[model samples]
Target: MNKPLVVMLGGSGFVGRHLAPRLVAAGYRVRVPSRNRNMARDVGCVPGVELVNCNVHDPAELRRVLEGASVAINLVGILNESGHGGAGFNRAHVELTRNLIGACKEAGVGRLLQMSALNAGRGTSHYLRTRGEAEQLVRQSGLAYTIFQPSVIFGRGDGLFGRFALLLRFAPVLPLARASARFAPVYVGDVADAFLAAMSRKDTVGQVIELYGDEVLTLKQIVEYTARCMGLKRLIVPLPDALARIQALVFDFVPGKPFSSDNYRSLKLDSVGGVDGLHRLGIAKTPIDAVVPKLLGEAGRQTLLDRNRRVR
Candidate 1:
C-alpha cells in the first residue's frame, strides 16, 4: 500500500521543524515549499520528505505545490511588520488565508489544517482581529479543514521564550510589556503533535482545536519561570502599557523588530485558549516550567533557578 502524501507550506519554520519528522515517521510522504530550500535540506534525508522553492503569496505556485496532495497544512505567518509597505499583519493573516483556501480548492486538496492563534476572535488587536477573520474564512471555505489554534509556542529553538532566555544572560533587567496579560504557552513539540493528530483523524476534519500549556501565567511570570529554570538572577521590570507602546515605537525601525507598537497592542489580549474547542480535542497541555530546564544550558539553568529561589 502506498503512503498518503502531505504537502506542508511554511515547512522551514519552528513548528515545521518539529512537525516534518513526525509526519515522516508515520509513513506519510511530506513535501515542503520554502523560499530558501537549503534551510530545509536536512529534512530531505527523513525518509520521504522533499523540499521545493516557492513564494507563498503566489497562488499559482501554491497550487502547484498543493497538487495531488491528500493533506495540506498552511503555517505561514509573520509577526514583524513587512518592509514592502504592503499589507500589515491583517493581510498576511487574513488575506493570505483566503488566497490559500481558493488555491487548495482549485488543486483538489481534500484535507487541510489551518494554523491559527488563541484568543483570536474578539478583535483584541489588529493582529488578533485579522487572525479571527482568517479563521472565519477557513470555517466557511467548505473544505474539510482542521484549525489548530495555539497559544504562544515555546521550545529549544522557539522565537518566543528562547529569545528571552538569551536576553536574561546579558541584560541586567528585563523590561516587558503587558506583564499582566496571561498566557498558557504551548510547546512546539505539542503543537507539532497536534498537527499530526489532525492529519491522521477524519474526526478532526472541520473541527477547531486549541493548544495550550498546562500552566496559565502572566508575561512577567513566564520570564521569571524561564529565568528560574535557567538559574539566572535577573530583575523583571514590567513596563506600563503606555510606556511599553512608546518603547515599541522607538524600536520599530530596528532590524528584526520582534517587539513593535503592534506587538505591544497584541500583548493586551490574554492568550489562553477557550474550553469550547480544547476540551473536545482531548489534547493534554504541557506547562512551560516542565521543559525549560531541558532546553536551557546546564550552567545557565542552575544559575537562574538558584537566583530565582533567592529572590522569591
Candidate 2:
C-alpha cells in the first residue's frame, strides 16, 4: 500500500518544522515546496519528506506541486512586509490562498488545512485582515477544509520566548512595545497535533478551531519569564503606545525589520482565545512552564559554550 502524500506549503517555517516531522511519523509522505531548496534543507532531511524548489505563488507551479497530493496544508504567513503598504500581507495571505484553492481544484486535492491566527479579521492591521480574507476564501472554496487559529505559538525554536531570549542576552535595558498586549501562548506541538487530528476526522471539516494555552500573560510578563529562565538579569522597560509607535517606525527601515508598525498594530488586539481548539481535538495543551525553562536553559548553556570556545 502506498502512503498518502501531503504537500505542506511553508513547511520549512517554525510551525512547519514541528508539523512536517509529525506528518512523516504518521505514515504520510510529505512534500514541501520552497522557493529556495537550500534554505529548506533541514525539512528535506526528514526520512520520508521531499523538498522541491518551487515558487508556490505561481499558479502553474502550485498546481504542479499539488498534483496527486491527498492533503494540502497552507502555513504560509508573513508578520512583516518589505514595504509600508499592506500589499505584502495581501499577497502572502489572501492571494496565495486564492491561488492555492484554484490549484487544489485543478489538481484534485480535496482537503486543505489552513493555519490562521487568533483574533483574525477583527483588527485594522493588514495581517489580521488578510488572514480573515484567506479564511473566507477557504470556506467558500468548495473543498473539505479545516482551519486552525492559534494564539501566539511557543515551543522549541519558537519566535516568542526564543526571540526575547536572544534580545535579552545582549541588551541590558529592553524597550518593549505593546507590553500590555495579552496572549495565551499555545504549544506548537499541540497545534501540530490538532492538524493531525483534523486530518483523520471528517467532523473537523468546515470547522474553525481556536488553539491556545491555559495561562494568559501580558507581553511584559512573558519577556520577564524568559529572562528568568535564562538566568539573565535584564531590565525590560515597557514603552508607552506613543513610544511604541515611534519605535516601530524606526525599525521599519531596519534591514531585518525586527519590529514594524504593522506588528504594533496587530499587537493592539489581545491574542487570548475564547474556545479551546486543542480540547476539541482531545489534545492536552502544553503549558509554558512545562517547556520554556528547559528550552531556554539549554539554549543559554549552548550560548555560553560557544562564547567560551570563541574566547579560547
Candidate 3:
C-alpha cells in the first residue's frame, strides 16, 4: 500500500509550519499550495513534501492542487483585519471553505481535514460563529471528513502565546481584554499530531474533535504566567469588555492591526475542549506549563531578539 498524499492550504502560517514536518515524519507525502510559492518552499523541503503556488479560493486553482491528493487540509485563517485583500474572517473561514469543499468534490479528494477552533459555536463572537458555520458546511459536504477544533495553540512558533510574551516585554502594564474568560492553550506539536492521527484513523472521519491543554487558565492568568516565565515584573489591569471591544474596533481600521472586536468576542468563552473527545481520540492533552519554559526559555536578550525577528 502506498502512503496517501496530503494537500495542505496555508502551510506558511504558524500551525501549518509545524504540521508540515510532523506529517512528513508520520510517513505522509505533503503538498502545500500557497499564493507565494517561494516563501512556502520551506514546507516542501520536508522530505516527501511538495509545494505549489495557487489561490485556494479559486475553484480551478484548488482543483489543480487537489489533483492526486488523497486528503486536503484547510489551515488558512486571518487574525488581523487587512484592507483590499479581503482578510475578513467570513471569506477565509466560510467562503474559502465552501470553495475548497466544492473543489475537493470536483477533484474527487477522498478525505477533508478541517482545522478549526475549540470555542466555535452559535452565540459566540464572529470568529467562533464563522468557524461554526465552516464546520457545518464541511459536515454537509457528503465527504469523509474530520474536524480538529483546538484551543489557542501554543509552542515555539505559535502566535497566541508568543504574542503575549512579546507584549509583556515592551509594556510594564498589561491591559487585558476578556481577562475573565478562560483558555486551555494546547501545544502546537500536540495539535499537529492530532491532525495527523485524524487523517489516518477510520474513526475520525465525519467527527468533530475538540482539543485543549491539560489545564485551564483565564486570559489574565495566561498573561501573568507568560510574564512571570520571562522574569518580567509587570502589573496586569483588566479592561472591561466594552473598552476592549472598542480597542479592537479602533485597531481593525488600521492595516495589520492585531486587535479587533471579533477577537474580543472570541476570548469571552472558555477555550477548553470537553475531555471526552480527547479520550475517544486516544490523545493525552499536553499541559501549557510543561512546555512554556522550553519555548520561551530563561530571560535573555538573544531569545527575545530571535522571537521578535520572526514576527517581521
Candidate 4:
C-alpha cells in the first residue's frame, strides 16, 4: 500500500526541518515545495521526502503541489518585511494563506495545520496583524483545520535562541528593546508532537492549540540565558520606549532587517500564552536549561572543528 502524501509549504525552515522527518517516520510521504530546491536539499535527501521548486504563493503552483495530498501544512512566516510597509506581511501571511486554502479546496485536501503566533490580532504590528488575518481565513476556509499559536519556539537551529546566540557571541553589550517583554518559550519537539497529535485526532479539527514551554522568561533573561550558555559575560542594556522606537526606525533599513518597527510593536504585547496547549495535548514541556546548553555545546564543537580545518 502507498503511503499518504503530506504537502508542506515552507518546509525548508527550522521547524519544518524537524517536522518533515517526523511525518516520514509516521509512514507518510512528505512533499515539500520550496521556491529554491537547493534551500530544501537537506529535506530532499531524506527518505520519503519530495522537495520540489515551486512558488507556494502562486495559487496554480500551490495547486500543483497539493494534488493528491492528504494534508497541507503552512509554516511560512516573516518577522519583518523587505521595506517599512504592511504589504509584505500581508502577502507572506494573509495572501499566502488564502492561496493555500484555495489550492487545498481545489485539490480536495482534507486537513490543514497552520503555524501561527501567540498574541496575534492583539497587536498593531504587521507581523501579528497579518498572522491573525491568516488565522481568520483558515478558520472560515471550511476545511478541517488545526491552528497552532506558539510562543517563542526553541530547539536546535531555532530562530529564537540560535540567532541570539550568534549575535551575543560578538557583542559585549546588547541593546535590547522591550526587555521586559515576556515569553514562555516552547520546545520545537513538543510543537511537532502537538501537530502530530492534532493530525491523528479529528476532534482537534476546529481547535486552536497555543503551544508554550514551562518557563516564563523576559527578553533580558532570554538573552542573558543564551550568553551564559555560551559561557560569555555580556552586559544587557534594556532600551526604553523612546529609544526603542528610534532603534526600530534605524534598523528598518538594515539589510536582513535584524529588527524593525513592526517587531517593536509586536513586542509591546507579551508573547506569553494563557492555556497550556502542550499539556492539553498530553505532551510534557522541555525546559530551556536542559536542552539549550547541550545544543550550544555541540555547536561550539562543530565551530571549533570548522576553524581547525580552515587553519590548514
Candidate 5:
C-alpha cells in the first residue's frame, strides 16, 4: 500500500523544523513548500520529505501543491506586518487561508491542521485579528480540520526563548513592555505531539485545541528566567503602558520588526489559556524549567565553542 501524502505549508520555519520529521515518521510522505528551498534545505534533507520552492499565496500554486495530498498542515503565520496596517496581516492570514481552503476543496484534500495563536480575534492588534479571521475561514471551510491555538511555543531556535536569550545576553538592563502580560509557554515537542494526535484521531476533527504549558509566567519573569538559565545577572526594567507604547512604536520600524505597537496591543490580553489542550490530549505539558535551562545551557556551550574556534 502507498503511504499517504501530507503537505506542510510554512514547513521551513522553527515549528516546521520540529514537525516535518514527526509526520514522516508517522508513515506519511511529507511535502514542504518554501519560497526559497535552498534556505530551507534542512527540511529537504529529511528522509521521506520533499521540499519545493513555491509561493503559497498564489492560488494556482497552492492547488498544485495540494494535489494528491490526504492532509495539509498550515503553520504559516507572521507576528508583524510588512507595513503599518492590517493589510499585510490579512494577506498573510485570512487571504492565504481562504486560498488554501479553496485549493483544498478543489484538490479534494480531506484533512487540514491549522496553527493559530491564542486569544485570536479578541485583540486590538492586527496579529490576533487576522488569526481570528483565518480561524473563521477554517471553521467554514467544510473540511476535516483541527485548529491549534497555542500560547507562545518555546524550543531550540524558537522565537520566544531563543529570541530572548539573544537579546538578554547583550544588555545589562532589559526594558520590557507589557511586563505583566502572562503566558503558558508550551513546549514545541508537546505542540508536535498534539498535531500528531489530532492527525491520527478522528474525534479531533473540527475541534479547536488550545495548547499551553503548566506555568503561568509574566513577560518579565520569562526574560528573567532566560537570564538565570543562561547563568547571567541582568537588571530587568518593566515599562509602564505609556512608555511601552513608545517602545513598540519605535521598534515597529526596526529592520526585522523585533517589536511593534500592535504587539503591545495584543499583549493587553494575557496569553494564558482557560483549558489545557495538552492535558486534554493526554500529553504532559513541559514546564520551562525542564526545557529552557537545558536549551540555554547547550546554547551557551555552542557560543563558547564558536568563540574558541575563532580565537584559534
Candidate 6:
C-alpha cells in the first residue's frame, strides 16, 4: 500500500518541526521544500520526510512541489520585514498564498492546511493585514481547506519563553511594551495534533479553528512567569504607550530587529481566542507549567555548564 504524500511548505519552521514528525508517525510521506536544504536538515532527518531545494514563492516551483501530492500544508509566515513598508509582508503572506492556491488547483491537490494567527484581519499592522488577506484567498480558492489560527504558541525551543529566558539571564530590568496585551498561549504539540486530526476529518474542511491555551496572561505576567521559572528575581518595567512606541522605533534599526513598530501595532489587539479549538478538536490543552519549567531548567543547566567551561 502506498502512503499519501503530504507537501509541507514551511516544514523547517518552529511549528513544522513538531508537526512533521507526527505526520510521519501517522503513516504519511512528507515532502518539505526549502530554498536552502542545509537549513532544513533537521526536518529532513525525520523518517518518511523528504527535503527538496526549491523556492516556494516561485509559482512554477510551488506547482512542481504540489504535483502528485494528496495534501499541502502552508506554514510560511514572517513576523518582520526588511523595511517599514508592508511590501515584504504582502510578498510573504498574501502573494505566496495566492500562488499556492493556483498551484494547488493546477496540480490536482485536494486539501490545504493553512497556519494563521489570532486577530489576523482586525489589526492595522501589516502582519495581521496580510494574514487576513491570505485567509481570504484560501476561503475563496474552492479547495478543501482548514485554517488554524492560534494565539502565541509556547513549548520547548519556542521563541516566547526561550527568548525571554535568555534576556532575563542578562538584563537586571526589562522595559516591556504593550505589557497589558493578553494571550492564551497554546502548546506546540497540541497544535500539531490539531492538524493531524483535521487531515482525515471531512467536517474540518472549510472551518477556521482557533487554537489557544487554558491560561490567559498579560505580557507582563508572561515575562514574570519566565523569570520565576528561571529562579531569578528581575524588575520588569512596563513602559507607557508613548515610551513603548519610541523603543520600538529605536529597535527598528537595531541588528536582527528584536522589536519593531509593526509588532507594537499587532500587540494592540489581544491574542486571546474566542472559541477553544483544541477542545473542539478533542485534544486537551497542555498547560505552560507542565512544559516550560522543565525545559527552562535544562536550558539553564546547559548555559551554566558552558559558562563554567569558558571560565575554566
Best by TM-score: 6
Runs of candidate 2 exceeding 4 Å displacement: 302-312
Q: Which ten residues in a row have the lowest lDDT in candidate 4?
A: 298-307
Candidate with more favorable, higher TM-score: 4 or 6: 6
For model 6, how does the per-residue alpha-carbon lDDT over 49-145 read when each residue is reduced to its tens digit? 9999889889999999898899999999999999999999999999999999999999999799999999989879999999999999999999999
Return the TM-score for candidate 6, rounded to 2 decimals: 0.97
Residue 112's lDDT within candidate 3 is 93
* Local distance difference test, each candidate: 0.80, 0.93, 0.80, 0.89, 0.91, 0.93
lDDT by residue (tens digit), candidate 5, 1-312: 989999999898878888889988889999998889888998899999998878999999999998999999999999888899789989989999999999999999989999999999997899999999999999999999999999999988888988988886677899999999999999999998899889988889999999998889999999988888877788999999999999999998899989998889999999999877888889987778888899998766766676688899
Which residue segments of model 1 deviate by more than 4 Å?
83-86, 276-279, 298-312
On residues 1-312, what C-alpha lDDT tens digit does candidate 3 reach at each position?
777788998887788988898888888888888788778766767777788878888889999999888999988877644552334778889999999999999989979999888867655566777788899999899999998888788888677667888777778897878888888778787777788878778988889888887778888888888877887778999988778878777877866676776677677677777854666767776777788876666543555676689998
List the candidates' TM-scores in order.
0.89, 0.96, 0.90, 0.95, 0.96, 0.97
lDDT by residue (tens digit), candidate 1, 136-231 = 999999999998888889887887678787778778898888889898888888888888877777898888888887678898988887787777
Displacement of residue 64 (Cα, Å) in model 3 is 1.0
How well does candidate 6 match the true structure, expressed as C-alpha RMSD?
1.2
| Candidate 1 backbone collisions, by pair | 230-300, 230-301, 231-301, 231-303, 231-304, 231-305, 232-303, 232-304
Residues 111-197, candidate 4, lDDT per residue (tens digit)?
999999999888789999999999999999999999999999999888888888888766889999999999999888888878878
The better candidate by lDDT, 3 or 5, is 5
